[model samples]
Target: LRQEYLQHFQAWAKSLGLGHSVQPAYNLPLGMQADISLVEAPELESLGFNEDIDLYRQFTGPAHLTGRNVISTEIGARRIGAYALTVPALVGLLQDSYAVGVNTMVIS
Candidate 1:
């Protein structure tokens, strides 16, 4: 029943030219007929690059699930570090994102 609902939802989403950020292994499947249909990174504290790597695994796990090599992230999307987010911390964040297979980004 869940799979049926998900399939129906996927079809509806694709019909609207949209996709959801659902984990294929957990809930919804990762394939949708949108220009871009993948996971999205949420705000995370600058807990160092090593620790941050795990933060995006959920998002990156299916980054390539759709056979599309597009990976993306949003920079400075955190209030934990505030404006104090230094270059190294930012680099670490980007590096972590890269390590997790993020190939695109939107810095704001």
Candidate 2:
């Protein structure tokens, strides 16, 4: 089902002239679950699985293994009451993502 979905998405992107520009981005937990369900045993449900950090590892692993040209992620700065994330904090988030093999980022 996942392959089918990817195929259809690729075709649709090609139709819209975005086949090369459209790269799949998977978030932690939910997106990880969807991707793992396609290829792995879904061991995330097992005890001792660290969903927080581990999901990032798991999600990035496949992109590297498959030799994806770009690995992108949606990043957000933590909100503090009335103010949004600080500039330094946002830079920290981008740096962390780069350390984890994310070459592209969609900031929120």
Candidate 2 TM-score versus the reference? 0.59
The regions of model 2 sitting more than 4 angstroms off are 15-17, 20-53, 77-83
| Candidate 1 similarity to native, TM-score | 0.51
- Writing each residue's lDDT as its tens digit, candidate 1 over 1-108 gives 544654666677778988543333332343323222323322222232224577467555544564546555656555565577778867877787778777765564
Taken over the whole model, the C-alpha lDDT of each candidate is 0.51, 0.50
Q: Which candidate is the best by TM-score?
A: 2
Cα RMSD (angstroms) for every candidate in the order listed:
6.9, 7.3
Clashes, model 1:
0
